[model samples]
Target: MATKTPKNPQKKHDGRRKNLIDNKNLKSPRTGIRKWVYRFFVAIIWFLILLVPVTIYYAHDLPDISEITQPKGGSTVMVMDRSGGLLASYGDVYGDWLEFDDIPAVLVQAVIATEDRRFFDHGGFDIRGFMRAMIKNITTGRMVEGGSTISQQLAKNLFLSADKTLKRKIQELLFSAWLEMNFSKEEILTYYFNRVYFGSGAYGIDAAARIFFGHNARELSLIEAAMLAGVLKGPALYSPLRDLERSYRRMGDVLDNMVEAGFIQKSVAEKTKAENVQIVDKQTGGDERYFSDWIVERAASLIGRVNEPVIIYTTLMPDIQDKANKALQRIMDQEALTHKASQAALVSLDMDGGVRAMVGGTDYTVSQYNRAAQAQRQPGSAFKLFIYLAAFERGLSPDDVMRDSPVILKGWQPKNYSGEYLGQVTLREAFVRSLNTVAVKLAERINRKNVIEMARRLGLTTPIVAE
Candidate 1:
């Protein structure tokens, strides 16, 4: 009471002014929260405004969804022998179309586990996986992980080129969203199994199963399924045919992933990993690969661009082909080093001009040059047959005496292979001995043009210089 009595008017006014200033500066928590909420909405509005134009720009050239039902790229070319046994396949090999139910559950589980663990939970794009991949890439300072989902990969493979452009990425997102909206999860997986590329030119799960396991998709075991699923990362690089060790290691990773995803027990995964996976021997017709390659080229020439799957039944006899391969290999193994011969080719044609067996080289894996078809080698002693036939047609008897000594024609001397010449020999003796000089003399006597004409008539399409 005493202090109030002594209080000055100026002090009272100062206190009131201070209270008003404090009240003016005060703010409610709800007001601050409302302000932040307003800003968030404005930012979202701007983002949508920008995204609309960008989406439109990338969407203009989007592929038609109707085309998804049809197959794309180089069509499969299946080459079969005379007895309908598959020799080889070129281009994209697609198996029979499969529905969702037709695909093995183990295979489906393996793919889901390895490719996208959250595939079932996410709607087209996986935010959690994308974020994780982004964070991992950022931490590693490199693109060690990809943010693409199965849906996005399928969309890109089905409709777009693998261009890592911003436009392509946007298109992929849009297409994936569209796919999610239009197709069910089961349908999406069905399309994936039917269209995705597995190594070795396989375009579908069924084809991969048949190619790698020699069976249908329904027959894929846990180990086989894991191996096939692992090939999805890098088809050519991880293909068993390309690298068995790498493929096996990748299969172990896929099995581990399956265990992590709770699709299979860890013990089961371990057992499956330890089990021996029998891969179908793609080298069954390894030597015939050269023949298959030739057949494909000839087929392409006969039929323009290959736009659809085709079956080519050729005159190749598998038994004869095996024999030819063995014969060339045996010769190369036994005498190749001594003669310094690195390559050899053999071609057997039937009387009807059908190629029964063709071995392009000693080892097709090492060299694919078709010496049987592509080489332009000198006929050497082989040409003597044409000369002898021409002489026979010119009314020369086999018993007629002919000089086997060196003969000079146009300053070119022809000598026998043995380098030792018999002065005079019967035509039959010269023919049997493959005497080059005698054959040349006979050709000169009968006119060289007749020999060339005979060669042409005998199905020799190669150009021959008459000298």
Candidate 2:
């Protein structure tokens, strides 16, 4: 056994060489796997490169088409009446719904100059704008404002969700490009006029026109138009109805912008501001806060939430909302004075089911609990709205007869409210009186379930339990 080892010393080298050759053969397959991995990564990088610019283009360029559909209720021209008292004070509602024609050229010029001078030139994403903005920001040592075009802002409002992420930016760019290709500049401007919010639940230029100047978009003078245009810079701060000083300052800026953009001469801007403005007092602007609240809630259904920055255009009657507000406030004041634990609510709904007004409480500062829209209460005799409406819907005319007498109802004897029993009375009289016994008798006669269903169909969200 010991003598056999010396003959195969070279054989040992031969076996080692064979092992190295086998390892080299396996390395080729490994190299192929590495190549495939590299190709996959390269494809993803290319996609991101193409996607970022395109996505940004679309999200920043397109108009929100969904908002242009006449909102929930009311027409555009309901705001033409304003003298002595508001149109809404006597139950006449005023709301403006502006399209392109309602806007002033001066207002448009001012916005274009102040916000994005190159808005007409850029294809959604403006490289020159980006570069200039970057340079300016770098030199200033902070980001003052983004050079986002109106189209981009519109795109963000319409399609792109306001999430600060690279993916969203890509979507925005892509959509912007498509928008620029599909829509004309005038079309884009039209959508922008109707979709942008102007504080106080004013969705479009039309709504803003009615609220601020007591007129339609068609009636805005140069100065009145400038005031509205100024609001675009800061709605809550420069709302002409809220802060006159801030509004005047913003109007001046708008005038300056118009002058710079060559839409107006310097003298014209000065003349417009001095002679044309008619600022209404904030206190007398009328109260449509309840209507605003209604729109805010419904707008969440349209976009996502009010906080999401999704654009909303609604057809709420400003006058009706104001009326509801005053009436509700009056009732709440009376209730509070009479009872310490009392809180009142009022709601005004249009024929089309658009909630015109919904006041939850008198004290918004004390609590934001919306009593009208959110609270569930035992409404007492006020609950008769369901019974009366139910009867009317069933073809029961006001002249229809329903016997009103003491009726023993399921261990609970329902009686006349005043303890005076009329031998026979019309259901109308009983409803007007809000008699509990008549309602109970009718509940016994008609399908209680059907009446309940009717109440529900009529937009009563409260739970109806038959006793």
Candidate 3:
């Protein structure tokens, strides 16, 4: 201190920081980037945590994994005769169930190729496949393909309804994931093959094989498998039974898919395409389906919801059904041009109310209305039977004479079908010749309520006007 420490003239190291003040005042671009990156990771973690609770809630409603072996029941209603002869079958027409190992390898390949090419590689959802499907559908302006995996389809068919909703889709995804975690690929595919619906009321692969090929699922040929797989796109649209041309085209598409997926070689696919499949013309063609349908609607109240196999004994006779179909066809072909009749129906019922033969319409595939039971055409002369019977019950005999002249009631004039009036006619003659004026006069005399009650007693269910 006395020498003033010979104070060496020197600058402090801390004062060098002042040289970098301008650089410190400027902000680096990476600071904001780092903050956002941290937030993004945190958001992802929160999303995963939230999904845990939602997944648990949905998992509780899912069927037990052990219950998967027993497929959800399907409706099956079998209508037969009193003699044990099968008349028709309604509801889910299923066949024998088959195990994974029992299913043919070619069929599995066909389904996987056509339905999901990345079936084995995905967990439950196929993002790449979904994206591709979206692009395709957007470009095509329609839903040309559904990117649902086999597991998802099985989940929907076994446990869910056909409602197209986001909640349902989420449930489907959850179930699909559960299926993937619990079951092997083969097991899931086996369940799918056993539960899917084919066209023509066929459910399951075995049923489809028997229904379309007249053979077991194990005996389905390669082309046949392709055709069956093709039908899965739109059961009714690509049904081989309804439209073979469309079915063939769809089969070719499936074959092409198989080739692309390496399930089959291109040459093999081409060869199979050249040799088309042969379908079995089952006896349940177009004609008997009408009877089957009519019997089903009538038996619905008696059977209720068909959950299991039910054998309903009906009074249908195949020979009679064939004869009736032929007779109706003959009549339509020969007399339609002459009588201006485009459609006709005939029902043969016994005294006990058992239907033996029924022809609903000219074609079942084209139109399903049962003319014999559904149509409400006015009975031109048939109503006269009830009117005359009602008059006879009121003490009028067939030999009684009546005026067949013009009659007007409430501004409604009833006349003969031939548009000509007879001056007088006996009740018997009026009955035989279907004289409209005489029948109206008798209805008036016997009181219209009596005629209405008589018609109601005769099983007329449609509406009747008094005027």
The model with the greater TM-score, 1 or 2, is 1
- By TM-score, the best candidate is 3
**Least lDDT summed over 10 consecutive residues: which range in candidate 1?**
297-306
Q: Give the worst 10-residue stretch by lDDT in candidate 2.
A: 74-83
Q: In candidate 3, what residue range of length 10 has the lowest lDDT sum? A: 5-14
Cα deviation of 158, candidate 2, in Å? 2.4
Off by over 4 Å in 2: 1-102, 137-144, 282-467
lDDT of 3 by residue, 22-92 (tens): 47776545567798998899999999999999878766776555667765567777777656777666667
Off by over 4 Å in 1: 1-31, 71-89, 284-467
Ranking by TM-score: 3, 1, 2
The TM-score values for the models, in the order shown, are: 0.55, 0.45, 0.57
* Per-candidate total of colliding backbone pairs: 0, 23, 3
How many pairs in model 1 have backbone atoms within 3 A of each other, for residues 3 or more apart or on separate chains, i.e. clashes?
A: 0
Q: What TM-score should be assigned to candidate 2? A: 0.45
Which candidate comes out best when scored by lDDT? 1
List the global CA lDDT of all models. 0.85, 0.66, 0.82
Candidate 1, residues 412-433, lDDT tens digits: the string is 8877888999988999999899
- Sorted on lDDT, highest at the top, how do the candidates line up? 1, 3, 2
